[model samples]
Target: MRDRIDEEITFRKLEVLLAFMETGNLSKAAEALNVSTVSVHRALHSLEQGVRCALFRHEGRNLKSTEAAQMLADVAQEVLTTMSDGIRATREAAGYSSDRLKIGSLYSLTIRAVPGIVIDIKVRRPTLQVELALGSNAELLDKLKRGAIDAALMALPDADPEIESIPLFEDDIFFAAPAGSPYANQEAVDLCDCRDETFVSLGEGFVTYRGFLEAFRVAGFTPNVTMRVGDIFSLMNLVSGGVGYTLLPGRVRGVFGDQVQFIPLKPQFLMRQTIGVSFLRARERDPNLLALMAVCRLRTRSVI
Candidate 1:
């Protein structure tokens, strides 16, 4: 019984019929659906065979829709509409936000990456509103875990069973100094050699702070004490104003223009931040998140 029903009618055929009815011709329907004219003709023919009736009749050189075809087109439109609405409602019940996507991000990313990503997402979903929540990496992660936001853009955290990540890009930690500093002329800075130099840092909750601590741990000594700031932009400005040197991700290199010099770190003291989107493991199938993941992947490819 199931096989007989499946053979007699199919969703794909309904879509083709609706396209044909709306477009008024084989080639036009094919163009609307992004399929070949031959495929459209074949689908309509197969649809007529399945229904065991005449859907189109010859008139001069054109095929005009018969009464059965017109009737089927009306039913097809209703069925497809109900099915689409049902699917969307089902997804919304399962945690998909159909109207707005709330995104959390590190404040640093807003300077270079977030603007382009937001613009592209808008182009893809014209009616969907995007809200950006900026905070430290830890803060963003907490919001994401609590459902305060739909997804987060920040450094990848340690592997967890409840969280999923899509890595967009990797950024190297650079030693940033005021433009007139002695280190400005050097190609690279050694973290171990700078054990006595004063340095600025994002607060402990920031991802870059984790990198800062880890690099020093690898260097076998703690960095000299200076003031710490709550945001990356302030910390960068502190470095630019000659308050103290700081380690920063390469992504922010363009933020300060020529005021700050970004130098690479020697190999043993090197660290890189893998920045990406993070979301709930169970909600990976949410339509909004899936679209965001697709956008992230596509944008990453273009950047590469």
Candidate 2:
């Protein structure tokens, strides 16, 4: 009996019938299913014969559902949902959980914020394995949209109504120089003093670099950026080696310690990027995502 029912009502036939019902035209259904119109007509015919009822009737250019197709719509939707649930549960049971959380961040947080958050999450949930992927903000957003990542730690991304964001922390940018540099001894160095100095900077497209440009404009000079690197640690290395002074996030000082000195600018320019959690809003209620969110919030509170 079960085999008979399965033979009569299979997923492929249901797919065609569902498409026909939605579009109300044989050609439209064929287009949606990527099959020829004749194929759609044949599938619908086969479906009607299997169920022993006429499923549709002609109405001008449309194929309107006869009582049976209307009746099956609700059932088809339920079956599709059930199939989705079954697949998800099967993958979970098989331990095929993806280790594909591709988190992207600015260089400053990659070293300071990302490591601690990941460690704390691991300690709290050892079974949930994670793989960290890093890139600049624009690249990361593209990856997230392409389904290459589950979530990201991004500075304010461009306007996207589909994404959900939760601000983690705000950090100020600061001027830092080697400890003995003339500007380092001052309580607050005017940006003008650093005009002639070679500077180490994060490559453009970074939040730090953007803030640096704003501060430079305020100071009335296009400061020379002699060295541009993608990562903050490398940039710090240049700073500590006295390669040049740079504007960096305050969090950077936590890692470099006394190797470099952080100085306030005379005008005390405060530009911050809000590090936050971002993911597709449509994916909001996922259990694993919720667990990660809780971990992020807890870690953020501890930091505060």
Candidate 3:
């Protein structure tokens, strides 16, 4: 037969018992816990039945606790305290980042989008430390899934049940070339005209690299890539230094406006990279994540 305590006892009942013990009256315990007085009475009654003992005695309209009740209350407090600490440690071990929020994002966003969000989030939570991890879109998403980062800001990917994505803004992919290059004079650059041009691109995992390939592919040719780099900043430097031409999102224009030219792509080759924040769906209710989400939503509202 199942033990009565094992079958009927619950942490919630213990909470009610502790509250009653602290407040010394069912009505007051209910007020403290924000529950009805009858609910408190029921929890205590159920707790006594579960332990199969007389934990309390009625004294007119009030209940008086026995020695056994005091013992159980002490154990319950210890158990709840230990469980709270254990849960925090476990979440940190699993990459939930309780003491600080570790956010991963594409290097391109660090120029503007990320810095603004970081400042606003810090303003909202003065004591909470925030760390930024910069990488390609794929790298950020990988870190998020592995629990290395609490959230990611990058090009939103296809739906995954485990991830909850919040779209913030869309950035256009522009044809990037050295400022003095012949292509810079154009109103809108067509990818087909650049087929004969040499290019430098971000390696396979980058979202911009994928856009680079698709734009040229639609032009009915593959780019003659001279070099492939890991990060967008390096790729931008190569273009500015006249290493070769490349495709980049408009977000980087601010940093390279003088050294490089960003021309809008012809309609057929144009693509918008949807930038957004993504996080584990399981952590949607987490207070830290809720704060970050609130900031992201604020940005979304502003841009719209």
Candidate 4:
């Protein structure tokens, strides 16, 4: 009988049923689940069929829960709540609870923003342990989605529906050239003027690369091919060595000191990258995540 019931009813079906009971409207329940209304209807219908009972009554186009449905909904709520508590308790026992937050970030932020943010969080929660992981924006986002990290600091706009973000600050993109380069003397350089110059860049997956490509597109010319490197420092080194010019955020201006000169792009082609903290919406209520978010809000406001 236990096996039979498990085979018939699913956890998702129970969640769907509870959503319907709480919202009292199929469309609202669908919205809450990030699913279509038809999917909600189908799940509820399948649930009723599996239980071999009528859980809802149709009053015109609306669904009203039956007495049996109400009882089941109560039980489902209790089960889910208990399961959540159990998971939390287990994680705590394993030292993977709210006291420890895994944070992921883009490699570029490691030089400045990330260190400051981490320091702020530490000052607030002295007992808290933070694990910092640095990677490309895509890698950080992927880690965030997999729950490998509690939050990620990356560039916007991230279109993933499952992730929620807080815009911390905007960093302007600049044209980088060697100190001796003629373009370095200008207050602002037109990208079109550099159309024939060799360009060094952080290959495709990097957010800076996308911004670099878009700036060129807006400038009405494709940059001459030269080098594609993995990290920003190396790309900057190459630029400082007079290998080619590259586009980078102003935040990284301090990295190579005066070795490379950063010039603002022409107004029409000006670009700014929005840097922010992103996390799964499902973990929004986690205490550690909430604390980190508060710190981010405070620190970003002070700096930016």
**Local distance difference test, each candidate:** 0.88, 0.77, 0.89, 0.86
lDDT (tens digit, per residue) of candidate 3 on 140-231: 88898888899999999778998999999998999988878998788899888877889999998899999888888899998899999999
Query: 1-304, model 1: which lDDT tens digit per residue?
Result: 4546538578888999999888789899999999999999889999988988899998897778988999999999999999988988787667787889999989888886788888888888889899999999889889988889999999998898989999999889999899989898778888878877898888888989998989889988988758999998899889999989989989888788999889999888788889999999889988778888989999788652
Best by TM-score: 3
Cα shift from native, residue 244, model 4 (Å): 1.1
Instruction: Show model 1 residue runs off by greater than 4 Å.
Output: 1-93
Q: Write the per-residue lDDT of candidate 2 for residues 103-210, one digit (tens) a residue.
A: 556556776678887777677667777777776777678777776777788676766988888888887778889878887678887887677888888887676778
> Model 4: per-residue lDDT, tens digit, 166-275?
99989999999888888868999898887778988998778999999999998898898599987788899999998999998988896888999999889988998999
Clashing pairs in 1: none
Model 2 segments more than 4 A misplaced: 1-100
The TM-score obtained by model 2 is 0.66
Where does candidate 4 stray beyond 4 Å?
1-96
Error of model 1, residue 27, in angstroms = 34
TM-score each candidate: 0.69, 0.66, 0.72, 0.69
lDDT of 1: 0.88
